[model samples]
Target: MSETILLVGHGSRAANGNREIEQFVQSWRERQPAWRIEVCFIEFAEPLLDAGLTRAAQDARRVIVVPLILNAAGHAKMEIPAHIAAARLRHPATEFVYARHLGAVEPVLHILERTLRRAMLALDAPDPKTTGVILLGRGSSDRVANGEVAKMARWLHEETSHELVDIAFTGITHPRLETVVQRHSRIGMTQVVVLPYYLFTGTLIERIQRQIAHLRQQYPLLRFGLGGHFGFEEEIFGLLDERVRAARADGTARAEHMMECDGCKYRGLAEPHESHHHDHAHTHAREVPA
Candidate 1:
């Protein structure tokens, strides 16, 4: 049986956000026509997790969910797992595996580097030795998650000859956008362009734009511009494909594996049964007809 991949993303209210993801999935489908590829949103969008799972289970034995999120935070840690559990309950026979969020992956850094280079070319900004880059990301409460972005910043600084490079957040943690911009401005940097390490435009991007506007007024001599978000990048799809294949190989393929309740009353029967255990207590059990 063919395995299915569900490219799950933190859905946005902005139509462009959804459009980008859909376009990426379409591009992925074109590369591998035999495998099933579906896109679903964690929240604030249609064809949600449950619906996506149902659709995937139709012909697939296993479903791999790859979160497009940048970090392992509220959505990746709590909400996504809860939804996956709910889907498992409804379709116990299907195999489901959750892949890690796109956290500080090499391809991601390449995408950022390309975007930054393009932005500089468009504005005729000076070489990296003279210009500065601000690596911006949506902050997270998870320290590990925050550290991942910081590591990316350090990598960018070391890889490029930018006079100044720093990581800042749009929300959730310190070294906020405004603070980063002002600090660099004081150093007599002629051009400071903000590169958003985000996949789509949302409230965070809008907030960044407003911050950039305010900074422009405060420092009229400084030149600033916003780079495009990561969108329809081929490298992204290649990484996603690798993730899906890994999930399938890791014994998480859904359709090919089946779990049997040996103690259930319907164990000997052909009908489906639902079993629930409370608080990880293996002894306690309740069965319901399915």
Candidate 2:
């Protein structure tokens, strides 16, 4: 059957971030020429979800909606599915499959380790066993989603040489970067690294850099460093292809590695309810990236 892949990105206010997503999509398109891939944003960028879906479903027998998000947060749970449901009604003949998010899987952990090591090398940091590492995520109100980040922190500690590894959020949660930094400082950890658990640069990433700058001033005795985000990596591309394959097989994006939707409060509710508009205000200060 003819298929179209509608890659949905969690939009950002930063033009460069959106451009990165677009460029990523373009690369995927070139890499897999057989699949008719289309890119769209949930907000803050052109070609919003509905419009992009409309364009993608025009001449395909089946359309797979793959969320280019890190975690299955609010946007993946409620917002994107709602739009996909709407697209289903608008195009009854086309099959719409909702794929899973780019989850906290083993491959992602590998990429993060590489990012951390590179950052540490650049800083000429001390032994990983002694140095403190903080995994900074774009925080979410969904406790389940937030737990995934915490899980990654534990996994990183287990997989790496770092003995002191912690997890913190950029916004909308406790144990923010500053809080973790303060705790690390109190513990007398001389060298600390903050790894931004993100795929692209966004407002929150910028805010994190600013926060790190301020932290450097606050803790003059301690050495602080910011690591790179999860940019375009082969592992990430492999995961994206995995999602597409899962969607093609079962049409529900079901995979053993991906998070179960049963934990989501918004699961199985795809109607465009009034509450959809009230779906979390993803503003500059309130938003959390995938």
Candidate 3:
């Protein structure tokens, strides 16, 4: 039985937001020719999680659900699991595994780095070594979620040659974008750029753009540019593949260990059908090329 991957995103009310997820899934499918992949929305979109999972599980024994969300908030923690539970109740025979969200992974950071570098080039900034980057993320009420953004900034500062790196948010917490721009202006960092660490265009992106426009006018001496969001990166597919494999390995290990110890009810989930075992192994054979 082939393994299927259902890439789920926080479906937006906006049409373009839905298209963005489909486009990303198409790109990911190209890189993963052997594995069966599909895109689904959690809400406010057609072909919801139940429909998507049922279709993918038609011929597959194992399915992995990958959340394209940034943080493990209410949606990621409660809403998503509830949907998965509904799907399992409908198709109890099929095995299901859930992967972590696409947070500040290395590939995401690489995409951010490339986006910032392009923005700097557009501004004709002479030296990246002397440039400072303000990495902006959609702030969250959860402290852990907010820390993820700060951690990404620190990672970029240490990994790249940029002179300084700081994180700011558009909502939910400080330092707000306006305050960060003002602070940088006070320090005389005229070559500062704001990079939006978002996956797609939305109300937040529009608000950030307005803020950048105002900042440019307020601080005429400081150079500012809005970097594009993460879109259509080949590395993103590789990251998805890695996440699937890691989740499968973890699930398999847990199943096997439980069988040996407690003779758990889910022990049968580990035993593969004789005819399906070979196909299952083949499904995981195609790895993203280094």
TM-score of each: 0.82, 0.90, 0.80
Candidate 2 per-residue lDDT, tens place, 180-210, comes to: 8888878778889999989998888888889
Off by over 4 Å in 1: 253-290
Query: 165-222 in candidate 3: lDDT tens per residue?
Result: 9889777678888888777777667678889877766667777788888888888888
Off by over 4 Å in 2: 252-259, 267-290
Model 2: lowest-lDDT 10 consecutive positions:
276-285
**Model 1 residue 102 distance off true place after TM-score fit, in angstroms:** 1.7
Candidate with more favorable, higher TM-score: 2 or 3: 2
Better of 1 and 3 by TM-score: 1
* Candidate 1 Cα lDDT to native: 0.70
Candidate 1, which ten residues in sequence have the lowest lDDT sum?
281-290
